[model samples]
Target chain A: MEIIELINVKREFKILNRREGIAGGIKDLFSRDYRYLSAVDDISLKIKKGEIVGYLGPNGAGKSTTIKMMTGILEPTSGKVLVNGKEPYRNRIENAQDIGVVFGQRSQLWWSLPLKESFKVLKEIYQVSDKDYKDMLDLYMSLIDIKNLWDKPVRQMSLGQRTLSDILAAFLHNPSVVYLDEPTIGLDVSMKSKIQEFIKGLNSQKATTIILTTHDMGDVDALCNRIVIIDKGKKLYDDNIENLHKMFGMYRIMKICFSKDVGELDYDSLKDKAAELEKELQENFSGDDMTVSVDEGWIDILMNEEDVSLMEVMNFIQSKQHIYNIKLEEISTEKVIKKIYEGGTIL
Target chain B: MKKRNVKFYLAIYFKIISQDIKSKLSYRVDFIISTMGILFTNIAGFITFWIIFKNFDNINDWNYYEILFLYGFSLMALTPTQCLFDNNWNLRDYVYSGDFIKYCFRPIDLYFYYISEIFDLKGIGEFMMGVGIIVYAWINLKYSVTILGILALIVMWIAASLVMAGIMNIAAATCFWMNNSGYVMVTVFKFTEYTKYPIDIFNKGFRIFFSFIIPIAFVTYYPSMVVLNSHNLPILTIIAPIFSVLFFYISYRIWMFGASRYNGTGT
Candidate 1:
């Protein structure tokens, strides 16, 4: 069954478009000029139980707005939002009881209270049974690696520790569904992986439906099997992770360390070589889909695997110059998002 | 299962308050200083009133002790309201900082969650000082204590606290419509200063405005008149509960209206 559903949900906010400065500010008090901004425009989605779905979007792309509606924090301007078979905004308390949400930028825990006290308070607030609470705590302790940090005041804990505790608190009630908005944001490598592992555990072990919103593609790669990408308040792509990789993850990066310094090469000489390489690759590979640059003592090459094979590019590079070492890496999400932002679409 | 038991909510509220107190008391020196500051300020205010009455026998027909009754009753009402609902006074800060979202998704009522977690320990000093002043004034007046009078005072005090809390809620709710409501709250709190004196001292326009429009008079003046066995209008005290309930309902309605507009903007 779908634990969360939004049918044509649209949220419009009336933002006062006031001018700047003292006189403008005074005039704004009586201006009555409001520009309507659609934070979420006709977004319809259904998230199933136990499915870890990544909700991806750029800044101000209505990602948090949709999460707010799902969490019953904001009522939709039009259409319906249902969580567990009830209108979330109308049945807010009931919806809240069955779901947990973590805003990575905000701490819901009491600022001065110990982490354990926050867990205790949330346990009562969600009315989790004693046995369930104890069992969940044990599981969380084993999974998240924050057991020793439990008694420390939340204000004293590091950002990563606080975020881990928040994740624990959100899952304490064994909620049927959870929304984690950038839970791994600003976390170190090890901490980020730990959180991702914990989120995976929650989904696999308890079958808790998880909706994750993050810019960290590592998070999407690690935990989410399906992803929904939105930009400018509209859905751009919604597909399985494997399919996303297969379609848009076509670029491959190659770095070659020369036997000698290449940085001493004149700009004109490098530019001429780059243009010649581009002409050869375009003629040989059937398209101009590669870029070459010299950095330090190494030459870096970025190529679309679809346009030119890695072996072909390597052979060409070897023929042109003496190679010391070579390494190839898949294009990063940073590159993919930049590509998408530049109007690239899944083929 | 949809609706939580009121007892469950009450238990959580107490736990929240106890946790707040525990956190507050951790800064022992700061807590002591804050409490002492409130006590000394109230004491200085009491001395000022005492000196004014020492130079003059009475202001109009009200004696020094009688006016003290009004002063003490106002503090008595104001302290508890401030203690339990102190966060309401800083609602604009909450909204501006986007911390108000913390209250929105809870399984408990948002207003209940907000009011329960905030307990101002400084108000304890005001409460103690007010009780002491009321005891001292009663002793000097030789006022006879009766069960009926005690009941009336208790009921009136609760009603007065409700009125203040409701007014604060209304003021806070304005943050939903406009940002930076510090001015609105300051203005409203300044209006409450007039409740410290007998309404009879004010002109007819001010008295009528206090009685009908803002109704600050009911919070202390009219309620204290009944408790002190003096009545400019006993019917005002008799109808205080009705006004209190009416104001509370209106404020609550206004809060709900404003809360629906809370978009967690700038979050």
Candidate 2:
């Protein structure tokens, strides 16, 4: 059975032009103008149980509007949203019981309380039994490496600590479906990896159906099997990860760092190497001085972000470089998301 | 179906409370400072009256003890509500950040979770001061000492406070749409301030509005009126409980409605 199903869901909002400033204050008092904005326009999607889907879009792409409708937090102006074969908005309680959500930029934990306290409170809300609670807690604490930090106040804890606590709060109930919005935003490399590991563990181990909307492409690369792309209140594409990469035509960004200090590589030198690497991989890579540079004894490489085959570029770089470690990464999920949004043809 | 009733909700409420307390205690200094800050505020209010009464005999025939009694009842009547709903003030922040998703996702009512998070231990100071004032006023009023009256006062006072808290819950819940209409809460609170004292001092219509429509009268005025045995306002004791239940249900529904209308863009 499908864990989530949305058929032609649409959301429209009324625009209020009454600006905040006092300059047009007198004219605004009597006149009330309403404009229509289709925040989520005729979007349809479906996901089966335990599939980790990367719901991607640039800012203001109606990705959030769609999620809000599916969660029953916002009523769709038209169309049906079904999770576990029930209308989410009409039957909120039942829908809610099966879902867990995490907003990356916000802390769900009480700022004044310890991490454990938030967990205990959630325990009662979800009404988990002793055994289930212990099992879920053990699993999360292990994956997230949450130790004594649980005892510390959430406010006093670092950004990493608060995020871990927030993640734990979302999954304590062992819900069947989970929604994560920018779960890795504003996180360091280590913290991002830890969160990704926990999410991956949940999806693989428990077969938890997951929907993640993020600007971070690494999150998609590390965990998701499918990607749903939306832009300007519309769904442009929805399919497997391979399909999104194929349709969007994204490329790897190879950044190589030298062990010893070296002279700056001018735009010509950098472009020459980039083109050479491009031909070697048989993929088109083009950039100017601004896109590619060498500064502070480190080599920075920006390839055609549209190309997906990083392994080819990896082999090419290995054959060429004497020895500094090289880091090759794709353009951010947000950037590929931007290309998909702007109606740019995939290269 | 019957198994999932009030007991189910009460259990969840207490669990959330325990969790909130645990979270609050994590930052030892923040907790102590916030709790202590309430006393300073109360002292400021106390000192204003002290200076004013020091010069004049009384304000419009009310002495310090009488005024103190009013303050005590109000503070006490307001304390429990604040403890329970202080987090309601955060509803605006919650609305913007869409953090209220935590409550909506739970099978239990979001009302309890949102209100419970409104924990503000600052009320402890108000609670203690209120108790002291009530005692002083009771002694000074010098009515015949009876155990039953004291018991009734405590019981009815709690009922009144719950009603007050329920109203705040509704105002706080409105944050779902106004996203920042949280300012409305402060406006409502400021509006409540006018009714905190005896409305009898005001004109006929204003007093009528506070007593009947808004029901700020029941919070301190009615219970104290019962204790003092003043006027012919009949059987308010019975109406108190009925009103509490009615308001709690209405405000709760309004919250659900607002939440439904919530975009949860931060969701």
Return the TM-score for each candidate structure: 0.89, 0.81
**Per-residue alpha-carbon lDDT of candidate 2 for residues B1-267, written as tens digits (9 for 90 to 100):** 234578877776676666666656766898789878888887788788678779977666766677667778888888987787777777788678656565666665666656766566668877998888789877896766678777777777877786687678777877765546867788777765654466566789986777676677777776676676544544765577677677777877887778766665543
Q: What is the DockQ of each candidate?
A: 0.53, 0.50
Reported per model, the fraction of native interface contacts reproduced equals 0.68, 0.72
Tens-place lDDT per residue, model 1, B1-267, is 535778888888788889879888998999999999998998898889889988999998888888888898999989877799888877888788877887787788778877776788899889888888888888888888888878888888988988888888898899988876889988988898888999889999999999888889888987787767544547888899888989988998898778777777633
Residue-level lDDT tens digits of model 2 in A38-105: 98888888899999998887787788788877887778899988888888878777777778888787
DockQ metric, candidate 1? 0.53
Q: What lDDT, from 0 to 1, does candidate 1 have?
A: 0.82
Find the candidate with the highest DockQ and give its number. 1
Candidate 2 chain B: 10-residue stretch with minimal lDDT? B229-238
| Model 1 agreement with the true structure over A51-149: per-residue lDDT tens digits | 999998778889989988888878899989988888888878888888888988688888788988888888888878889999987887667667678
Instruction: Give the distance in Å from residue A181's predicted Cα in candidate 1 to where it truly belongs.
Output: 1.1
Displacement of the residue A227 alpha carbon in candidate 2, Å: 1.2
Q: Is the docking of candidate 1 incorrect, acceptable, medium or high quality?
A: medium
